[model samples]
Target: MRLSLNKDSYEDVNLYFQDEARFGMMNHLGSYLTASGVKPIVTYQHVFKTTYLYGSYSPINGDSFVWEINGVDNKIFEAYLGAFSNYKPKEYKIVVIDNAGFHSTKHIKVPKNIYLLRIPPYNPELNPCEQVWQYIKNRFKNQRFKTMQDLKKWLHEMINEMKAETIKSITGNHHYVNSFITTFKI
Candidate 1:
């Protein structure tokens, strides 16, 4: 399902929530989920390292992208793939992603259970995630930190600080709105 991440929405961040009969979903970061830190200690370089540009500037329709951030790109990639591997039904519907590099990258071990489809190139509107980044980026705008520990700390703190309704406003699935236009029952 397509979603938005406008500053008015979820920021430039993607949270992967999975489900089944139980809706028993585990949330993972789609765009970036840098789960690296110095445990309880903090450092400046760590924070600076994590503060790289996080946007789709010069967003070419087919620009190659990588899940960069430290050395955890592959780890994050497998984590999401694992979602399909572990929980995706043996027979399920299509899964859509942007034409970003990471999603388009070919793998020798593509799973057969679910199809990986990409949103047409240059079509960010088809993916709700564009707005998610805006919301997340806005949350940290005009903010500065000295270390990665601080960046991580503030992110965790700000996330908790976000109002529940606010989150729903951004990522909540409102299929009913579209269904209203269509005659089909969802």
Candidate 2:
């Protein structure tokens, strides 16, 4: 789809893929290295408490904005958009997202500088932010957190230490970059 920007200048326009992921006491079990013949035993948690991480990633430049919230709802999503709007006030942000209930434009107010573009339903693969979530969740594999604060603290440190170049390597898919270039003629 062709997106026509209301802004006259495209110089500061940025394309971002946004998504949310739940991180909690529940551990993600991934492959583990063990003795050649040994079955690796991993501990798992059933705690239901979770914090939702709302994130927006610009594959073009590896720019990212993230917020940790208790849950997902229209109100919370609106606030996230507002915060992201202020985070990069000068840029015209075009955020591509999946069709989640909280992402419905009808229920939430989008910030003036931000435009929401919904990808086709059930097409999570199209959003590069999925890779960001995967990269983060992988870090949580085979791990346990004593409390929500500990999880949040670890998450904060992990996010802060992430370099833009590393993010670009993880999320900068050629297809997405090419689409952005072709669509925006950047």
Candidate 3:
């Protein structure tokens, strides 16, 4: 639904979210070994990369959410599209996203109720969800996990603990977005 009093072309309500992040041994980048004299090596038990977390953010309502994902595929993204379509049933939902392959795959059936605004190729800076992911990842940098499930659990905990205000403060402060909001009093 339109919230602005001014009838502007920017009537499309931009809701940024719907991205994925992998959490596994591959994600661990801070492992180090230390010793007194002779260097003692630390060996990490090899665990295959296994989990993917999909999340979405609503700039208008400051709703930052993580979708329960079993795997990463076109079907997963389609499900994400369906969920977001239902999330804001009344609003004219415009999701700003990079052209990830899954997002454009033939298997992905984007809901008619939602519109996808694909950002220019290679321009991730236009999408604020990248910043949201970086913020979360930075918090878990160098963390070592026992198993894939443990990594998934850690991700869930971290995401759950993220406050809406914190997400807004991080992902909602885009220069162009803020300028529009200010200019239109949105």
**Best lDDT among the predictions, by candidate number:** 2
- The reply for model 1, stretches above 4 Å from the true place, is 1-48, 51-75, 83-94, 108-115, 160-164, 172-186
What TM-score goes with each of the models? Answer: 0.47, 0.90, 0.75
Query: What tens digits encode model 2's per-residue C-alpha lDDT throughout 73-163?
Result: 8899999999999996878898998999878778677887888888999999998899898888888788799899999998888888888
Between 1 and 2, whose TM-score is larger?
A: 2
> Where does candidate 1 have its weakest 10-residue lDDT segment?
18-27
Q: What's the number of clashes in each of the models?
A: 18, 0, 1
Comparing 1 and 3 on lDDT, the stronger one: 3
Error of 3 at 17 (Å): 3.6
Which candidate comes out best when scored by TM-score?
Answer: 2
